[model samples]
Target: TAGDTAGDTAGDTPEDTPEDSPVEDDISSNKKGRFHSLGVGELLVVKQKLIAYEEGEIAHIENVMKGEKRSRNHRTLHRTEEFTSFELEKEEETKRDLETTTRFELQKEIDSEVQESTKKEAGLTVTGKYGPTVEFTANAGIATEKSSSKSKNLSTSYSKEVVDRSVHRIQEKIKEKRTLLTIDEVEVINEHSFGNLESVAEHTNGIYRWVNKKYEAQLFDYGTREIFEVVIPEPAAFLRYLATNHPKEGTSIPKPQKPGYMRLYPILGTNEFEEVFIPLSPGLLTKETYLKWVEKYNIQDVLPPPSSFIVTSIAFAIDPVDTGVEDEGDGSLTPNWRTVNMKNTELVVPPGYVAKIGTLSLAIFPLHRFILRGLFGEIAIGTNKHAFHQGGGIGGSETFVLSNETGLVPVAFSLTTKQFFSGTLEVQCRRTEEHMEAWQISTFNAIMNRYEVLKEEYEESISGEELFGSVDIQGKNPLENKSIILNELKRQVITQMTRQTFDEFDAMREGVLPEGFPQQDVDEAWSEGQYVRFVEQAFEWENMQYLFYPYFWGKKKDWPVNSRLEDTDPLFKSFLQAGSCRINIPVRPGFEIPINIFLSTGEFPWDSGEGGIAVENEDGEEERDIFLSIAEELKAQQGAVYFKSDGTVFHANEDLESVLTGDLIEEVNDDGDVVLNDDGEPVLINGTNFLEDDINREINIGGKIYMIIAVNEEQQKITLDENISIQESVQYGIGAKAIGVPWVVTVPTSLVMLHDGNKLPEIPEAP
Candidate 1:
């Protein structure tokens, strides 16, 4: 009944109201309306009428309140006046009661309509605009008339089992795809032969590793003189399975030597060779008599022979023309030879007697005398000790001896021929004792013979028109000319001897010699004896050939035979050149641009060892030289970059010093110490003139070498002729030549190519 009354009141229009009504007239005149003094129940009825108006009629009421006409003839107006506090309270209470009753009735009607709609839609499907039609099945009738009860657990279990099997199959498929997409291995082949330029694609296998999200491979060739090509597959997560583990730093554990691989030793220093002595027997003389004999002989410093030794000797032969001339030379061509005199010095001469042109008798005897002091301080007896010493002791000791008994000592014999002879001259090297092996004697003989042949050829070359035409030696006498040739011959012989000695040493160490050879005994003795110490010494003096055999052997090919005296020494260079190796990387798509990294082998001149520039000033404080500081800064900024094939355009990130014209802060290591060489001298990774001499040079980086065809020192950029991919975590040793100074620096490769400022190329999804 309230709903009907409210609806009726809401439906009433201004036309429904009588025009003669006193209440309407009064409201129109005042422009505001006040409710008549009615009871709370009447007000409640009025409030319901107004609240029950439809949304469209509410706008009409609002217009009437604003005194706006809804039609041309009929006008509507509505207004409200504040009521007394007590009257307003009473009116609010009545209005709330009416609203609550009206809401309760409306809710009841909505529930009734909803029940009717549900009954009509039961067991039917309803479709929506956005989704598939869903059907609802009613089970009310079945529940009321159920006759039998059963479990549906079997059906549910079957569905669950099917789902699990489906999920497992999907996972297996994903794993299989991943495995197939992974790049396991990459192979690198030389594009051109180093020895034979026409021959191409010499296969040289190298090891590779994926570290720190980058692929790295070892280089076999020193790339300084070789071109290489690397082939790799697309990058994928599964490729990591084929990566080799990176070597840990400062690891004391020695790697297991592969079969047939020669064992290497560290370079020796001067101190290790200071007081060299050789033991009479191996393994510390277990015999009590021998020990007592050693003590009785007062042998205070007896130790096993060094793992290896370098023995040097010079042989000079004069021409009859120079030697036969009266007052010009001695009549006897045989020079006076002095032998060390010892009490029990018995010479065992092998049965071989032959005399030939340039053939001289070589007596291999110990030169140094070791005295055995008696109880009364009188020298009881003295034994001769040969000048067979370790690497660093060569030419440092007063003794100049060669004993055939010392098989491990490599004999570097030099022969100088002073005569200008046309025919071949056979030089015989016969030892006084059978202590020398046949092979050793033959080796020495072969060296002399080679020297003789070379000397003859050289003499013939210069003695003819070439010598007479030359302004420098045009009027020189035959003796003077022979002297010049002899000097050259001596140098060639020494070089040949040194090379032959190293070869023999390597052969012995590798155990590649004939079986049952005495050299085997020498090898074993050296290996079992102080071989570890020897290796350590070799490593310490890695840059010096005289101290480190392996370093010398590795760099023997690069040795400057015709270089200046200062250039022949490693200490003067300050950087060791390492052999080149190959590296392979699986790079993301769109980032396949080849990047050539140029490295310099420069170091701070002040931080150099023996022959290096001074680092400290008169005040005893380390002086910071501007040039050296620049050198140090350049070393820190050494990094890899992406370069175009044109060798002009290159890109590098901010981490690298893309611009060279800036002041740099000095860098100190974590220990607060500057980088130093083995001799504790301050050293720069890149030498002092790297920036100045960085243009147009081939640099070995991550086993690949790139020639910097063009360089922009201001922008710190370089270009290459060929493209190279940039790989993170690879080492770059850049060799650069400055103004009369050559050096090398090891740069760590860590860079990414940017298409724009701080924007990287889009990496495609792994296949």
Candidate 2:
């Protein structure tokens, strides 16, 4: 009820909640802060455009052609070349999709079921005035209103109704339910009977698609050829989601369900974002569509009035104690809990995208619930191989930089879904790097080869095992499940691979090892018999290096390094081949592939504490200040422009919902104007709610030139008349072709034209 118009104070990070080690994070989400990440789809937009030097003046892609000569009767005719968009290989895309679906094989973590999920369960009361109710009836089919008189015959209650008295009681309770509840207040402590959530088709063949941006998602026909994968943000948000929205809840909270993208995206945020999207197919219920689907049959009444569904909140500080920047910890980074209010909840929408038939900005963006999904590791590719790394445990003894000859790292997705609310969690890591070897890339040629055959085979096997060659997801698929293909692929990759697996030395790569890993040799290599001797040697090197050049990571910038004594474990020496990770020849894109390696160790040695996770590189002061300022500016503009930036410059055009309320690229400036990205080169937008029109309405870009492009509306429709080969399509379909630059159509405010420049044709819009 109490919203800080100026926003609230930041909260402490979960890491700061301090206890023992970062192992398994014993901290509850309330204390833990959520982590944010930019998806590959988003990176695909500004990856190349990123400025090499943050402080250097850089040149932009020249827009104006050198001195034009347009005299007398000569007129320029700009050629309009068509892109000739083609359909991607559906079969291959399907396989990739299924593989991701099978990724969540792990079960639940702690056993805590949501006993009863009800907004009004606490029985809080507002005691407010009543609004007028309208007569309405429960229509059977498509919304073609029944006789007005017949509808009017219905009884009276809250907002609008034409139903029975029993319906009236339930409806009133629901209305009160919504008004009395806030997301934080409405807790689903346990799972309810999601009444037979599996598919009810004749053969039990079903698949599901969940689009989670907040705590809810819309279920869809997993059978759709064009749709498949889902994305999630980082760890903290996701963990919270799991703790709150898991199926453990009872009748109090109906299986947390929401509508389709169009109805939900605006509520999430204003951009296509990182989500813990599961390509799962929940089975069929009697309910047919998202808008009217009823999971709990006893419910009836006015639908809950619109409210913030998913909220995004960020808490941060400039300095951290871990950096030891200050002796008294004055510079320590901290989370400001005051910022943890409801108003801080963030929702987003994609850029250059809009509602299907409205002036609305991009819509149908994903919403995440309890859990936000994301990359726990980073992967890089080089010459014949690549390197991959996940955050390692805290400590110097087992610390390492494991290098692999073959870039094939096991790419597996595992989630421990608690089968029951209250019980001991028996997590038996089942999903292996089944398709670990298929991931390939060439930085030189800029080609990234991925082998999904293994993933595809596994899906096929899953489909067959589910009684009658199918399992029950939320709904039924028109075709058979592809789990069989996924299973078969796994069989081949696993039974055939020699080096693409956990190695004997894997436990010793560097950092903390799982409880039982070997540790004898490691102790000998870094034997610190006399702390005094080592300390003396360290001081000598630091003094010598300091005279020549500034120290880097303590040593001189170019100090010749010796292998860490800590790396005596042989795992660092072993190089595994990734050839079997795939079954096909490679296709490389631009840029030479850089080798990548992964050990059990984390990318960063530092682990999060009770306070929070380690503060990332960017403090985002310039970006943060500019963004806050823009939000203030938007109030004057009636929510026209929203901002998303990586503390760098260019911001992508995001949707209005996100624009209205999201982190600003620029915080409020002294004069209270939108901050410019240095007022120079083309701005690289991470995501935005601001448009070209907003430039004039908000701030001055100093008349900067930004290339505007139109979208290929027909891109979504791609079955063709031409003859095509499956292999060729598979190579390019789901891989790189889908990743690219925004369409260059019209400027943010510039208008397209009719021949006479008087009137233009009207077209239905979409997100």
Against the reference, the lDDT scores of all candidates come to 0.26, 0.21
Worst 10-residue lDDT window for candidate 2 reads 590-599
lDDT of 1 by residue, 205-306 (tens): 222221112122221111121111221111111112221122122232222211111224434762322222332322223223233433433344443222
Tell me the tens digit of each residue's lDDT in model 2 across 1-767.
01101212223322222224333322111111111111112111111121221111121221212232222342322222223333332221111112111222333334333344333222333444456854443322222222222111223232211111111011111111112111211111222221223343121211221111111111111111111111111112222234334443222322332222222222245454332333212221112321242222223332332222212112211121121111337644322111010111111112111111111010111112221111122211111122222222110111212222121111211112111011111111111122211111011011100112222233334333432423323311212222322233332322121112211212233433676644543322222212112112111111010011111222121123212211111111110101112221011111001000000111111232221112223664321111123343333223122222222122122321111211223444589765556764343332233233222111212222122222212221122222222211111111111222233221111111113221222344886
Q: lDDT of model 2 at residue 666?
A: 41
- Supply the TM-score for candidate 2: 0.14
- Backbone atom clashes (below 3 Å) for every candidate: 34, 198
Give the number of the best model, judged by TM-score: 1
